[model samples]
Target: MTKSTFHAAPLLTLCLVLWALPLGAQKKKDNLQKPMAGPRATALRVSWLYVSADLGAQKVGRVQIGREIVVAEKSSDWLRVFANTDIEEEHTSDAPIFDTNDTPPPISGWIQAKGIVIDNTPNGDQILMGAAADQEALASDPRGPVNAARTAHLLYRRLVEMFPNSPLAAEAAWRAADILWQLQKADSSSRPSAKEQAPYLRDQMDEDGLKKVIKFYPNTRQADFAAYELLDNKLCGDWQGQEKCPEKESEIYEKYAAEHPESPRTPQALYLAVYRQAVLTDMYTADNNDKKSDAAHNHARELAAKLRDKFPQSDYTARATMLVFKLDQRIPVYGIEKE
Candidate 1:
């Protein structure tokens, strides 16, 4: 046969063989030739997690795809099994063919792109949704919370820097703080203090930090409470034993009352002031035996008069009035004897 004819004959025969074998059979043969990982079937490692949902109506066992999220605490969906490792692409084969360089095929592209939910609280959805822009920027790629938080931190920092005067800037600042705090909390190496955890709370602050908040957002509702916290912290500390305790407490009350006369906590501030004065004066009189003493007599009389006149409706008013009358009865031999 001619060279051209001989080649054409083989090509025709090849076409016939290709056409004759059905698609399904060819696919089956290909699958059969694929090498398998080992004798055991490829299966993921899974664990059962106890879950309470439906107000404890349904107790379920779940496999943890990732971490337990706070939001999941209330979810009705009982269980989730997740893939731990990549799946082997090799199938069962008769021939012992080994490819040392071949790697397992990764999971479905989309399932991984969803990443893992951390907090899973009511607010979690918002945080995740907010991250969509970021996820898209990373080329539909995926990573864990640690990397996600780092990305979020960068975004918030940029937002804060770019919009310094905007509320969004403040929010971003808080978010950045929260992300750092969360990362620290998630780390098992060390624990953080209440003060250290304050940043993660987002615009919320500890006592010292609240002072800064009050200063920065003076008219804000948060500042109103912050101011009270500052004053409460000061008053409840060492001031109680000092000679100027009553006076300092009184000054704080007056200032707070003046600044926020209509505030709900105004009564509380006033009560604290009056209480301090009454107690201190009582201590002074009880300590000094001499009724003729100027400091004791003057302070006791002054506080009693102040409470009766200024805070008649106060809870301490009735008690203070009786004290004033008692002080009146003790005014003998001071050149101003009681009638």
Candidate 2:
């Protein structure tokens, strides 16, 4: 071969190797997190993970109800599997996991196949949704499992991920996001900064999942629910005896009502606007600003009228009526009444 041909051959080999390096690295990275090759499954009850397929085998851990697993092999009534066993510690006080990447490695063990629901199981989406609803109810009970909320959240998430085309996917996604938002709200409320008047002064709940629900399920009732939850981030932590607090909050609620007239939350938003304007009327009265106070009173009455006209049978309309009565009677809706 010519000397130039030899040199060109080496150069071509080097170029090919350089091009393959990134692909090779990406493949390795993907392999590191690749789920076990098997049908995705979840437990129907609290099941024990054993070192072997026998009931007498050493117990390694547990598979909580609705926790995702991959069925790799089976022996009669027992199945060998890889399961996500990341059980968070029971928190005595409100606390939230800040790190999203804290997933523990999946544990490999054997569990009973009797209660295992696979992705292809008939009515699997409904089954998962029911299980998640059960867990959510348990989460609300004072004596229920500490991780019930988190488990329900995960189960709902798994339903959405595993059965994206199912009829229940949108609702499942909303429930998952709502659970996480509530959990974060509880933790944020427990902090000292929660007493601050401005929302910016306090820790905020993560909004990415809620935003995803709105993005992926537009025009759905679930999307409307997510949009209402987003308003919590814009609210004052505490009114702090300020007129501006109610003034600003009333505007926020009024805008929400106008923009989402068909939303289920519209009545509540209107009621909130009425309530805040009533409070502002009181605040302005206390400040001896009669002009602003009269304007606030008129606005409160107008919102109450809107509530009654728009949502005649709504409970919020009744509440708005009561607020209007108080405003007309000169009863203070906020702070102490003038002696």
Candidate 3:
């Protein structure tokens, strides 16, 4: 055989292999997005989870490729699961974490069962959907009353644990913190006083957890919430009678606002940043330390003024106006005296 003829045959064979690559790649992508419907279903295989078990059910949400389902119940083709933000709560009162009657309603849904690929558990098509689907799905559950909210929080934690290296990890972690905060407020509304609510709020949404979310997913929406929550939320300590750590709140807000100039979070964060600085002044005066109050008052005023000029139309601007007035007139901040 002539050398040129042999080369032509080899070139044709290579061309055929190259031609098939896209189809094979596409098939793999589809498999990762959803498992083949078979005799048994596994959790975390479907990309777009159906609202119902029926194959034709409308898409209600998505299950991340690797999110673990507690799987309270399952049919041959579908699994029932829950998803949400996870928050840590400490028992502040003798009150059962919640009244036995108040057990959070289970947030439940159905998803097709799929299989796990044990050998390729950590990489490739399993990791990216170009955007974070499972992470978002883990968070996508509609905010609900305490019961459903609690379940959703559990789901977030599951996603984080099951896919620690996935891009969605930050989102899952943030949702977990957010849910716990919401649950905390709900639990406390029925209670009598700050002393009573103090315990419940003490350790909920630990500071380090929020910091980790921001550290890993700095520009994501989850990070934005984590950053803001670390300041304005209890994660940074806004209560009294417990180990007080409210002094650091203003610094976090200022740093977050400065770092993300155009972030939507910046407007609100700047406003709260100023609010918390005034809080320090108020706290000092409340504690009978007028000398310690002066620096915070000055800084708060500067931040308030900056907000007034930079974000005149922000939702927090009116509050900024009130902040300036209070700082100047030395009006005792309404809640500061007691809290």
The prediction achieving the highest TM-score against the true structure is 2
lDDT at position 199, candidate 1: 29
Q: Could you tell me the lDDT of residue 268 within candidate 2?
A: 96
Clashing pairs in 2: none
User: What is the model-wide C-alpha lDDT for candidate 2?
Assistant: 0.80
Better of 1 and 2 by lDDT: 2
lDDT of 3 by residue, 140-231 (tens): 45652334454455445544544556666666677666766655655544445433333345433345556656666667787777666655
Residue by residue across 160-268, what tens digits does model 2's lDDT show? 7567778898899899889989999999999999999999999998887788788788888888889999999999999889888888899999998888888999999
- Taking all chains together, the TM-score of candidate 2 against the true structure is 0.82
lDDT of candidate 1 over 127-208, digit per residue (tens): 4335533532452255544345555554443333223444444444444444444444345224333223222322322243
lDDT of each: 0.40, 0.80, 0.53
Instruction: Identify the runs in model 3 with alpha carbons over 4 angstroms from their true place.
Output: 1-146, 154-173, 184-201, 204-212, 231-247, 259-263, 279-294, 334-339
Clashes of 1: 4
Q: How many residue pairs clash per model? A: 4, 0, 16
- Ordered list by lDDT, greatest first: 2, 3, 1
TM-score, each model? 0.32, 0.82, 0.45
Looking at model 2, which ten-residue stretch has the lowest summed lDDT?
Answer: 2-11
